[model samples]
Structures are given as structure tokens and as C-alpha cells.
Target: MTSFAPDSIVLNRKLPLWYQVSQSLRASILGRSPQDPLRLPTEEQLAGHYGVSVLTMRQALKELEDEGLITRHRRRGTFIEPGVQRGAPVRLLGSVDAIVAQQSGMVAKLLEHGSSPVSGELAEYFADVDEVATYHRLRADERTGEPTNHARNYVRPELAERIGLDDLARWPMTKVLRDLVGVRIGRITDTVEARLADPETARLLQVPLLSPILHYTGVTYDEDGQVLDVAVIHYRGDRFSFTVTLDAD
Candidate 1:
């Protein structure tokens, strides 16, 4: 006999009134009462309970079914899918070069080099204090003389002020950061997302604009956990699939 509260429904920002109403009802079923396998009420029951039209309630339930959150049968009615939880290895950490070097050798190319004032996003990421100088941004492609992964990296200006752009074209930037700047590498945070390739990204990766690609954003930190560099890499979806080993425990 749990009571539904007025504030429990969340309206979808992009949808119409009926869709918003449906989203709210779906949220109640999937988010709040997920453990109650047999609690799915009929369309009329939900309409009266949520103060929405029967059609709107049905539309919301349909969306949930489309998302594979619930299933319906002739007489059995809709039921929540059992939750599945999994764990993965926590110790897997390394740079892209280090990981690839273990498998095969690859070359890094320095394509574009420039500097600009740190934006709000970059400032927050770098913990830049005061009016920080422009940061050196480099766009490079890593491969075996062919397009593999398109990468863009940003480095603090002061630390890389004396370094020549030609030096990066000849050597790995990690070496330059360690040997010249005297910054010790700490840890890197890597995030992967699936996205359709834009014109610029497609041109760099030698693929069509509508092609799918995996966007990898990596943030490198120094010994004090201060961000040293941020890299956005685009990898060809057909050629790359990341496999992470997980712990059963």
C-alpha cells in the first residue's frame, strides 16, 4: 500500500505532454519500485493513480517496453527485467602508447601546433590559477604510417615555453614532458563514448561523416594529482574494440 507522491514524476524536457506523462510513469516503475516485480498496474490503474489519460499512460509504458525495461504478454502483463550487476578489474591502467607498444610498434606524428588562452573547461581541468598564459595544443595522428587514432593534446604554456615544435615532431611528447619539464607522470583517466563522426573527425580518420567512432578522452595527472595534459582521441570503430578483463569478485 505504498502511496505515489506528486513530486515523484519526472517530466521529459524534449517530449510532448503525453510523452512527458509516460516518462514519469516509467520512472516510477523502473527507478523507484524496481524490486516489486508484480507491482505493474494496468493502464487504467496507472492513469487514475498518476492523474494522466489512459492513452498517455499506455504510451509511457510502451516506451519502457521499447527500452527493454519491461515485457508484456497476453495475460501475464508487464514485468520488470531482472537487474544484472557486474564487476571489472581495477588495476588496468596505462597510456595508449604503452598499451599498443606491448602489441606492436607505432609512430606518432605531430600535425598542428598552437597556443590559446585556457577556456573555462580547460582551466577547471588544469586547476589554472589567475590569468594563466596560453597552453600549447598539438594535434597528432598515431599509426603505422596510416590513420589509426586521431589525438589532440594540451600542455601548460610555461612548462613547454622553451620547447620547439620540431622536437615533438621527432619524439614522443611524454619524453619531452618528463625530460624537459621534469614532471612525473601519475595516473590517467580514460573515458570512452560512441558517437557518429562529424566532418572534421571523419576527414582526420579518413572515414565518412556518418560513420560511427569511439571517442576517447584521456586526462593525465602529475605526481600531485594536478592535470598535466588532456587528450581527445577518435578511433575507427571498425578497427578498434576495447576489451577489459573483469574480476568475478
Candidate 2:
């Protein structure tokens, strides 16, 4: 079995010193104090412990803050944000199917279903395709009654054409891919970013603008690494945190 190593910071001339320091601290927090939400070290304490200037420590903290890994209060001090948990560290593969399967009682609603040409940035993924293929768009919610995430997925026409959009209101798209499409997922590539919810997302998620949201861009492939589907999911920052394990080897 091929096991991937955890991502880490390389302390070299190629990167800035503050960034390297921040990465080390972030890794420590993710690895050590995940369960204790309020266990973040004070900025001054961190600077003294790491043998860095207070400014450098502040810079490190700023980087973590930008990544949504930590939060700062005026006088209350810095703390880990609530509900953000580290997830298992695996290859960037099969994440969608795995996540949906792990979380029960989640529901998917098919918002739009159709076929269109792959254009712009998406065209690069399909290669040599002129006409638009079948497309499946869905909104997946992670809550029983109140939705915790709003996800949109796009798949190749041939793979998605036969699946009924109406079926999503009842079952997750992953199930449809398995039962209707008959494609066994092999790998997935995921890109994560933190952004404020848009107006539509804010309204649908019942949150105000500037509310934190985690955007996930994912692509799933078959056993032979054939592209199966691409998905974009938005999760409520206040409700969830992605987790991954890292080992120092």
C-alpha cells in the first residue's frame, strides 16, 4: 500500500521565515490541541517559545487567521474557531463519496439538470470536446432539517444524462453515481478555500454576508483514473471544520 506523507513546511531560503514559523505552529495546533478549542498559545508566549520576534509571531498568526485556522479577539486573546475539526489525511482522492457515506441523514436536492458545452476554465478538464455534454447540478445539504452545506456538482453528459434530477431530493448524488452510473470511484482531487458567503448563498444558508464559508472544489475519478465528476461545495464555516491527520516521518 502506498501511504502519503503529511504536508509540512520547508525551512529554506525559498520561503519567508515567518511563513515557515506559522506552518510549524499550525501543524502543532492541528496535531496536538484539536479537542481543546481554547488552548491556543498567547501571541507573546508563542514568540518567546519559538525564539522569534513578536512581529514575526504576529505574522505567523496572521497567516493562520487568513486560512481560517485561528481567530483573534480584541482583549480575549487568540483561540481556535469552534466547529472546525481536522480530517483524516488521505490522498486527494475519493473524498466526495467517502464524505457523503460517512455522514448519515444528509440530503441532496437536484436544483438544475441539463447538458452544456464545456467552456472557459472547465474546458481544460474535458479536452477536445466541442459540444456540451450532459450536466448534473445539485444542492446537497448536510443537516436533517437545517442545511449545513450547499453543494453544486457538474458531471459529464453521458455519465449524468440518464440520472433523474428529481431523485436527488431523496438520495445523495454519490448513490446515484454508484447505482445509476455504475462507476466505482477510485480517486478525488480537492481544493479548499475560505470565503465570505455570497448573497444567494447567504440567503439560502440563512446567514448574513461576510459570514464564513468553506468552498471545496473536487474532482472524482474511476479506478483507472478516468475523470468521473467535478463538484463544488460550500460549507457553513460556523457549523463545520475539515480534518486531516499528519505524521512526522
Candidate 3:
């Protein structure tokens, strides 16, 4: 019932001005109700609402038109194309259970899986180790083909050599390491931060420029405090949320 009204979209500088207009308008169409009137605001109204030039606004509308999400009539005004699939509900989780519970929900596409150098901060952080087997996976919402998160995990080269990308795609690192490879786990630490979606990241996540996102860095350690593995996740804030409990101190 909540539509992305033009008044609600604030402009930002990270992306082209016209593209921002288009993104906001696209969100508007996706959130609109089926029974709701399909008429889009007039070009003048839109330009005024979004505080952009009519040329910029028109360019934005043209972008939407090219996408086949809407059409314009001689006198009837712009309208949402019938039968457009409503965007899926934003995924609301941050764990393996959500990733594996459904067969076609969240699956990782292995982009690169091989040994990578450990240098700079990571090298210092894992001073006891040098190189690591790295797997860069892009997780997507299969139903919508929208990327939900990107994960890059590192494991000891010895363990990495024994792990297969196919198995990693189907299971979490913890599961692969603990059950398949029989690695002993001790403790895991996760640090979370709020960040803006950079150009590259925004493209992968299909979100507008400067959209808020969550960056999670986690390290798994053995009993001896040697780093067993590390994982970094970039989650689209619009699609995922982290749930945590608090203890009164």
C-alpha cells in the first residue's frame, strides 16, 4: 500500500541526476498497488516534485520507457505496463539458515576461487598465515535475478585445496570447513558497519547510487587463536537486516 511517491525520493550526487530520477520513478512503479490508478504524474509535476529540469525529467521517463516497464499514450499520459511482476519482498535475514532453507532462494555464484595473496591489513591481521584460498561468491535472489549479497571468504591454503567450489556454493563456509573438511572451530567474530553503495557495488546489487548498505566482516579462529578463515559480506540494506540480541550489563 506504500507507493514510492516522488516527494519521498531525495536526490543525490553519486549517480547522474537523470538516473536518480529514473531510479526513484522505477521504485514508485514497483511499489504501486494493482488496483491503484496507473497514471504517472505529469512531466511538469514530476519535474517540479523532484526539482530537476524538464529535460532531465523527460530523460528519466525515457529511460523507464526503454525498460518496457511503462508506456505513454497520445493523451492518456504515462501508465505502468500491465503484468509487470511486483518486486519481491526485501529479504530480511543475515545467516546461513535463510540461505539454505529453500532450494531456489539464495545461491552463491562462484566468481573466483583460488589462492590469493594476504597483504596489508589482512596480512597483519593474520600474521601467522601468508596466502589464503579465496572464494568470491555473488549471492542472488534466484526468483528475481537480483543480487542480494556478495561474499568473499578466505581459508587456509591447505584446507582450501581440499574444498571444491561446487560444495561451497551449496553450503556455508562454516559448514564446509567443519563438516566436510573436519576443521575444528573455536570462535567467530563479526563486525558490522553501515556504508553507501559505491558505483561498482550499486551495479551488482541493482540499487541506486549511494543507497545505504551493510558491510559485515567476520573472522573465524581456532582454539590457538590462529585465524582459520575470514569472510566479508556486502548486503543490500534495502533487502537484508541483521538481528541481534542484547544482554543487560
Candidate 4:
């Protein structure tokens, strides 16, 4: 019996009510602990919780059912699919330390690792080097084993040699770079935007084709102000939210 606060359900009047409600419910489903039972509240109860009509709640549940997230039976009620929790919508916090803390419990699986020639868009970042090490990894919630992030990393050749597969699978790249590789980080630049997932992305993330995703591009620079790594990470749009707070002077 997972519950959410009324304030937690922020509905944007500009968006379709059903869509917003579905997303909010999806977040709750994914955020729930695996130890919890699969059963969810009835449509009427859920509708009451969301302050939407039964019809609207039914529509929202249908969306989740169609996505293979949940199954419904007139007599059995609704049960979420096993091993399907996508974790909560991660709030992208400021500062490397905060970001690292946010990623603490995820389990990483190394997908691909090798050295590639520096060319195309990455050429500018590694202009001085002829080749760079590349890795592709899938990160999932340790508790539920539901995939949440797919990342491709391009590391500077010099630093990449010291990185081990075991480290990559166990820790975030930022941690590997700082704690293991002993690199001094001078700055990190990140840009986030919405994009539709391609076939590969959808397969890795267990989401539908062309589903909206949060695309993140990050560049890490060393103490000398040279690019140390370039990372591209993709997150399910429904499973993440970026947060930033500004202080008024």
C-alpha cells in the first residue's frame, strides 16, 4: 500500500489530464519497493487519490497496462509485472557529490568496452589524441533489477588504461575517475534535453520505441582544463526529473 502526498501530484493544466495522471502513477509504481506486493489500489481509490474522475483514472491505468507495466483482471485487481520497478524519478541535483549520492544504489552492467579512433563529434574533445577508450553500460535499480539508465562513455586514452571493467561495473564513472584513476576534476558541463528513443535505446531500457527520453551530454575536464571524458546518458523520461535551485541575491 504505497501512498503519495496530495502535493506530490503536480498536475499541469496545460497537459492532458490523463497523461499527467499516468505519469504520476508510473512514478509511484516504479518508486515502490520490490518487497511490497504487486497489488495496487482500485481504480476508484486511485481516482480519488489523484482527484480525477474514474474514467480518467481508467484511461491512465490503460496507458500503463498497454506499456506492459501492469496487468488488470476484473476479479484479481491490478498487479504490476515482476521485476518492473524503474526506481523513482531521479532529481538531478547540483554538485558532483550530490549527484554521486543520488546514484548510490544502482547496479551497473558493462555492455561494451574497447578503444576507438577519435573522430566525428568526439574529435574536438580529444584533438590531441588519436584514439579513446569507449564503454557502454546499463544501470538498473539494485533492489528491483529494473533498468533506468543507458550510458556511453568516451575516456581520454591516458586515463582509460587504468580503468578496470570491475570498477566500471561497480561505480559511477565520476567515482572511477576520482577515487580510482586519481584525476583532479576541474569542471563538469552537462546539458539535458528530451529526445525519442531509437530501437537500440528502447531495447536496452525496456521501453517502447520512440518513447520520450531524457538525453544527457556531459563533459568532464581535468585540472589543467582539458577534456577528460565525454559521456552520453539516456534516462526514461517518466523515471527522471531535473531540478535546479537559484538563489536571489
**Please, what are the lDDT tens digits per residue for candidate 4 over residues 15-98?**
567766776666455544556678888888888887889999999889779867789999889888765444544443334543
- What TM-score would candidate 3 get against the native? 0.57
* Tens-digit per-residue lDDT, 56-152, candidate 2: 8899889778767678998888876554443312222223433443232344454555666776867666665654444333333332356666766
lDDT of 3 by residue, 1-249 (tens): 432354244454544677667756765565344566677778888899988999999998997798676898978888878754322322223322222221123556888887878968588556767688889888775446778888888888888777877876665676577657887666677788899998978888889989999888878877778787888888888876665533242
Best by TM-score: 4
> What TM-score, over all chains together, does every model reach?
0.51, 0.55, 0.57, 0.64
Model 3 / residue 8 / CA error / Å: 47
lDDT of 1: 0.55
lDDT of model 4 at residue 231? 90
Which pairs of residues collide in model 3? none
User: Candidate 2: where is the Cα deviation over 4 Å?
Assistant: 1-97, 131-144, 247-249
Could you give the C-alpha RMSD of every candidate to the true structure, in order shown?
A: 18.2, 12.8, 16.2, 11.3
lDDT by residue for model 1 (1-249), tens: 554332233333333445555444443432343234444666677677767788877777786676565677867666655541111111122332232221122234566666666778777786654333232322332222445566677776666675666655433455456555677777678788889988887887788887988777767778889877776767777666665433343
lDDT values of the candidates? 0.55, 0.60, 0.69, 0.76
Looking at model 4, report the run of 10 residues with the lowest lDDT sum. Answer: 1-10
lDDT (C-alpha) at residue 110 in model 3 = 89
Error of 4 at 95 (Å): 1.2
